[model samples]
Target chain A: MPTDHIMKTYDDELKRLNNAIIRMGGLAESQVAASIQATVKRDSELAHEVVEQDAQVDALEAEVEALAMRLLALRQPMARDLREIVSSLKIASDLERICDYAANVAKRSIALNQAPVAKPVYAIPRMGKLAQALIKDVLDAYVQGDADKAMHVWLSDEELDELYTSLFRELLTYMMEDPRSITAGTHLLFMAKNIERIGDHATNIAETIYYLIHGTPLKEARPKRDRSSTSVVLPGPVAVATTDSEETK
Target chain B: MPTDHIMKTYDDELKRLNNAIIRMGGLAESQVAASIQATVKRDSELAHEVVEQDAQVDALEAEVEALAMRLLALRQPMARDLREIVSSLKIASDLERICDYAANVAKRSIALNQAPVAKPVYAIPRMGKLAQALIKDVLDAYVQGDADKAMHVWLSDEELDELYTSLFRELLTYMMEDPRSITAGTHLLFMAKNIERIGDHATNIAETIYYLIHGTPLKEARPKRDRSSTSVVLPGPVAVATTDSEETK
Candidate 1:
């Protein structure tokens, strides 16, 4: 084949790979949303659907992996072509894990429904929606090949994390006041966490995008001191004692 | 370099990368464990230490990434070498996130202790221990290249998930009984979850290791249908509300 023909062929392969991933992502996004509903409404059937769909995701993951491997072995692609393949592998893994988290949420929802739940099912679904959008935005970024779009998705993670923190506080108090709340409270807490993890998976996709474009990580600016307006405090000066205990353990 | 010299040099470089990763794993594990103690004991200083130590983990992640890039460029190694380098990148990402989860747990601890906690804070610490060891063992499997060990650690994720689920349920029951327990219960929930996330990260590492050694994903046995003989009753049909309430807005 002529050099241009070879290049065109590789590009076509990459296009196919990206499309495959997008299809996989659609399933992943829906899985996340459905999982939230499953838990919120105690719909075990939706949970089963999410779990069963994981197999399809897995099959797609394998297909994409094979395509990526073929490109590497045959074309030895460079630059964006190579980056595209690497991103596919990472995205497949993230999507699979997001599904797992959704199933977990569904499972928890069923558990909480068994006995009267401690509190109204307030923040968990909101958290799930945020997570679902993160997945959607990241996938949109991939489809558009827009780095800025990916960056926007990355920023949303902070808000999700903050929401999770608030939810965590509420749940912890529930457990303490009535020991009975412990069982149902644990289920809700995991449901919230499953949503948080989905956010992390979305961030992973964004991070892969960063590497694909710049060959550098999405370098986070670490705060040297307390950056938040609120002065975040530690428990006490038990660092040494904790260190000793760690040693003994 | 002669082929033999090239072989030994490759081995040496791989060993250095492995050692650095193992050291990073140890540091990450300790960070998770200490963060748990900070939360359970309400030790603000240790919580600060955990937060401060996260920077070190981030730095280590960068160093690993830089080294992996050098190998990719300088060595021009084959697929096996490439797999090893990619595995390192994946593991660094996992470790960095685990550290973030730990820091989160510690931060929550500080928040919880500022007010009177409502529940007994016993299980989170133990969960942290299991999670930290999972990180350690997964790394050990990668370094020693024991696929079996890695698989063993991967299998334990289910048990960890169960523990977190139980903890969640207990917390919810508390919130249901009394409104007063909300805040403390939620904080404890976050603490348990951070530990649980550490276990998930460990599984991510093990999955990466399997890829590195096997030149593919480790063959996962068909995950049997979740008999879900526990709290979640599966196979429930979905019901849709055909109408929206007038107060929906």
Candidate 2:
């Protein structure tokens, strides 16, 4: 009876840890959504709210860390339990980073508001929506212990990357065509990059969830389609001409 | 004698874990330096090499993770050993990310070489050198268990951020002035941001080391001076004149 009681208590603690991560994930999801809305609306107050809410995510991470450490030290959990605990820590860290990137998008949105919104600025909310979906799906995967769902999120990151690459080119063209848009364009570019990175953190969480359920890291190389790192958009007449063609399309 | 022998073996495993982190740290340092060299010298071959070396860092991270998990399960390490083990996992993850940023810089460098070099490119090596030093000093702090030294690296991040802010403004002005430079300037902008992020990972490692040694998180607010997020440089006369004043100075 005593052992059964202790086992129940351990289960409760583990559930508490899981709930903390889920709560943290919810905060991250909201922050990303709010930041994107703020960027699109040019609403500084909403941006500030996103920034303020990030502290809560950070606090949740600290709380999860403490509880995880205590469980590891006291419970001496083994096998699946140990993996679950470790994955929780990793997942929390990724969620914390996701929130940070969202806050960064908000910060840039504040600066971006100073200038007239660039045409490419509209691409952000689309990208933001994709990243938000990924976060939501990955958290659901975590909650359900659904490796298939997690794997789906992992593979879907490629679409986000492709979207980002196209947006990168568009932003560069917009900036070069109207030098006036450079300030806004650059801020929007970084904001897009930040959202792209949030998609990445969601991929990271998906991987952690897969590992937690399967006990092995995803072996194949993750599909990395974010060629924006190596992307080049030439300036002057050529870039402007390209934009002109696109506009006709 | 049996307990003593087990204790000695446990000590050996911990030492090996520490050495693996040090080795991993060395790889990260080399990747950053080589990437920077490639960027400054426009050496595509060296950049390729930096990209190739990133896999080794990734492999080491997996190895560290495996070993840490094994130790936790078998050793049931408590208190300081547990903290050290956990910190190793965290530090390895940071180093892995540092290498990823370095690889990204390399990737961007390859693209950057396609265009004629931008003048702002010269500042990359300065930033790179600073990031390289922070990595080196932070690793030494980890090795020596020197919290004070770790704090030093932690604080030095502000200088790197300040440098990045100036480089950012300069790059934006250059791009607006000559659209031809936009291609190279954007690449350089990303490369500089990559190096700045490397500095951030060093600060993360320093914090991990501090926690490992002191068993308490640094309570003070980390001084963050990277205002480039909200930084804006308008296009046209205002920005050009700002550059002109700086040129005279």
Candidate 3:
């Protein structure tokens, strides 16, 4: 075959991979949306659908990997082609994880339905909406190769983080106030965490998009705002707490 | 250059990539170990060291990625060589995440030192040791191409998951019994969760090694035993709770 013919065929294969990524992203976004709906509505059926649908995302990721490996071996993609192909693998993995977290949230929603739903459970959908938007924007950024849009998604994740921290405190305080609510509150905490992690994966995809477009890593430190890792909520009427102490210094 | 001479240089380059992965694995293992030590001893300095050392793991992962991409483009490796190179990208990414989780554990440890230590904090080091061993064994499996050894690491992760679930219950129960311990218990919960995630990444590396050596994906459902997400521990004198409800059914 002529080199021109081979090159054109390789370009087509790359396009196929790109389309597969977009499809995978669509599945992930719906999974996140449906999972959050399941939690808020206490719809076990929708949650079950989300959990079962994760297999499709995993299968798509496997397909992307096989196609990528074949392209690397046969076409020997270099420079821009190589970066795009490599970024696809990383991006697919991140999407797979985002779907996994969505499924996890769905799983916890089923558990949450066992007890009286806590008041804070409503906050899950609000956070979920933000995460879903980030996934959508990041996927758009990925498909269009828009670094600025991807950067916007990256910066927007701080809001989700802030929301998660407030929810974390609320759930703990709720659990303490009504010991019976502890069961539901714990599940909600994990569900919220799953959504927060989905946001993080969106940020990761943004970084991958930035790298793919610029051929260089985004150099600025990420604007991370999740302080829940060190957060402490004391159980009392005063409810006063220290976020950190000198021992950490 | 002769084809034979070019093949020799490619072989050397592959060896260099292999060495870098091993070095990256070593750093991740130590980070897990030191981060656990920091938590057990409440040593802020040691925790700080683990946090600082994560950058080396990050740098080494970047080096592996660059080398893998170079080999894929320049060598145009086929069959086993292609699989090995591709697997390095995945394995390095998993190791990098293991280090990130380790750093997270270290960060939580520093925060934990600020408050009264919970009795359940001691379970963290136990879980950490299991996770560290898994990392070491999986690294050896990757380097030696020992699928059986990798499978061992894969199965042993169940034990870590089981341990984490028990710790999750213990911490929640402890917090309920003494409301004053809630702050410390929350930090300990995250630390244990981080260690459990480290174990998960080790399992991920083991799966990559299995595929690399066998040329077939491991089709069996992993013996996953972490039920903490659905776990609901009620607060009462009897301290009894249901793990799940019919809504999941």
Instruction: Enumerate the candidates' DockQ scores in order.
Output: 0.14, 0.44, 0.44
Candidate order by lDDT, decreasing, is: 2, 3, 1
- Per-model tally of clashing residue pairs: 43, 0, 0
Instruction: Give lDDT for model 2.
Output: 0.86
lDDT of 2 by residue, B70-168 (tens): 899899989999999999999999999999999988888888887777789889999999999999999999998999999999999889988998898
- Per residue, candidate 1 scores C-alpha lDDT tens digits across A167-210 of 65555554555555555665676667668778877877888887
By DockQ: ranked, best first: 2, 3, 1
Interface RMSD of 3: 5.0
- TM-score of candidate 1 to 2 decimals: 0.77
Model 3 DockQ reads 0.44
Q: Each model: TM-score of chain B?
A: 0.84, 0.94, 0.95
In angstroms, the error of model 3 at A88 is 1.0
Measured by TM-score, the strongest candidate is 2
Model 1 residue A119 CA deviation in Å:
7.7
Residue-wise lDDT of candidate 3 within A1-249, one digit each (tens)? 698898789889999999999999999999999999898889989988998888889899989988888888788888889989899999999999999999889988887887776799889989999999999999999878899999999999999988998898888888777766766777787788889999999998999999899988776767767777767677787364545421110
For every model in order, the fraction of real contacts preserved is 0.10, 0.59, 0.41
| TM-score between candidate 2 and the true structure | 0.95
